[model samples]
Target: MPANTANVVAEYKDPADFYNLINSDEFSNDVGQMLKSFATARTVPGIYETDVSPKEVFTSPVSEIFRIKIHGDQAKETTARAEWENFTKTLNGKKVLSGVSINLEERLFLGIVGWESFEVSRLLNPFHWARKLKFTGSRKIP
Candidate 1:
């Protein structure tokens, strides 16, 4: 480290935000138990809010699934059309249960993500672009 040396840069958008629900000791404990349960199932686990809604569940259909509750200025300009296009292109062969967008009431403009009906159990992973990522959630609508 020298004068005028280059350093890592991280621009904080919302530094004053913290969630008591997820930050408390009780939450940590509960999360630990949840992880244990998940592990027992021997399946992958998605990040928090990874898949907000399950796909193709007409029993109790949901329009959207959100990962992060907050977002920056760039994501605000997006629309459901963009999502629809992506699903039609990317997840074309897969079964799509529903696709809807909802407001997180946070900083971000786009926090909603949808789940493909055939990929409902795939919520444990969402970043897999090509092919399949073996992951799913344990919530069956029916």
Candidate 2:
């Protein structure tokens, strides 16, 4: 196995259980660990501020909007966006994520490094983190 590779096994009875697991602190910590293991360190440290809240527009299938402001390194924005795209692509390959989607919008401020910033907005599906599964005869399935 590769140095950055590991296996995780989770058993959930239903969608709600899967949702709860994703929203749990334990799952967040696991994701953090995976990020630290697989992600490369930036040569220059960047400052970033992020906000996430329920999206006000569409209530039928409740969603969240994620906004981030990044400063110091312009390349960081590109790198961050690429990482997000890769993550979503991976998610799309999973059968559990059928109707989920992520929309990204970006804006760049042209000026001095200290004065300039990169803004990114992501419209997140309500079930972004949840893993939906169907199980039968003790066999786990997605």
Candidate 3:
């Protein structure tokens, strides 16, 4: 079993800042290098033990997906919409779900009210937030 199996989620307050970072040359170059590394590894025989090739894992056409919803004043929303459109155009064939709304329920569900409350809740009932442990195979297979 892999010991480093954790996923991180990033939240950005401003849409333009997010777009700007992703569209920057540094970010683009890093992504390109990662894809190139995957492609290069596919050429090495017996490098990947799995059934799926590196190309299949990295170059899948349906991998890129973005869902963005902006909630703010009319002027801010309009500016964000225009920025999102420009960003999507650069993405080419990627799937993008875009919308603007001011739903209090949705905000309540997604937003973290306070770190203190979050930490206290987790401390009170750790199991409520903990992930279930998964075990595979009775013995190690070399």
> Which predicted model would earn the best TM-score?
3
Higher-lDDT candidate of 1 and 3: 1
**lDDT of candidate model 3 versus the reference:** 0.32
Q: Distance (Å) between predicted and true CA of 110, model 2?
A: 18
Ranked candidates, highest lDDT first: 1, 3, 2
Lowest lDDT sum, 10 consecutive residues, model 1, at: 129-138
lDDT of 1 by residue, 17-122 (tens): 2244446787579865664643434532222221223322222222233322224434422443344346446543443332222324333222233344424535
The digit string of per-residue lDDT tens for model 2 on 7-115 reads 2324333446655665789877987566566456632211122221112122212112222333444574555454444545643332111111121123321111110
| lDDT assessment of candidate 2 | 0.30
* Clash count, predicted structure 2: 0
Give Cα distance to truth, residue 1, candidate 2, Å: 40
Rate residue 16 of model 1 by lDDT. Answer: 27
State the C-alpha lDDT per candidate.
0.33, 0.30, 0.32
Per model, how many backbone clashes are there? 9, 0, 0
Off by over 4 Å in 1: 1-18, 39-142
Model 2 poorest ten-residue lDDT run: 109-118
Per-residue error (Å), model 1, residue 108? 10
Which candidate comes out best when scored by lDDT?
A: 1
- Count of clashes in candidate 3: 0
